[model samples]
Target: PDECPLAACVNILAPCRSVYRWQGKVENTTEIPLLIKTTRACYAALAARLLQLHPYEVPEIIAVPLVAGLPAYLTWVATEVLSSP
Candidate 1:
């Protein structure tokens, strides 16, 4: 939570019910997944923060690069995250 605070970006908290096999056993769990919408620039910082605070030995930190987006929306995302030159 401290890693990616609400103030860090426009975050969406999603409840995820997951079922998977681990240690030769089927497991089911409900997890709170955070959908964080921030700029590419913030990715590294955010990931580092997550590593520092995440309880899991290996946290699930995955980033899908934005290949296509609405022009206006893309511009807004860039504007929101770009550092001042």
Candidate 2:
């Protein structure tokens, strides 16, 4: 968590509730899901890093493309993920 910039984006962990089927039964769970608001260019790298650092063998590394968002907010995401340059 400390190694990921998204975890620090707002200085707070995003709260989430997840539901899925497992072992032939539906289950629900609550988790501190971190929504890493990063650019397309950063998705792959961030995902790879998460896989390496995450304890789960198959971490829930899903990337939902930003089709539309407030322009200012999208710009902020881009800036937040920009590598030192």
Best by TM-score: 1
lDDT of 1: 0.67
Error of 2 at 8 (Å): 7.7
lDDT of each: 0.67, 0.70
Tens digit of per-residue lDDT, candidate 1, span 1-85: 3433422354657778878777799979887787666566677776777788788777788887778889888777666663323
| lDDT, model 1, position 21 | 76
Candidate 2: regions farther than 4 A off: 1-30, 83-85
User: Which consecutive 10 residues in model 2 have the weakest lDDT in total?
Assistant: 3-12
Residue 24 in model 2: lDDT = 92
Q: List the residue pairs that clash in candidate 1.
A: none
Candidate No. with top lDDT: 2
Which tens-of-lDDT digit does each residue in 1-85 have in candidate 2? 3555643263337667889877799878876776666777776777788798788788788977767999888777776674433
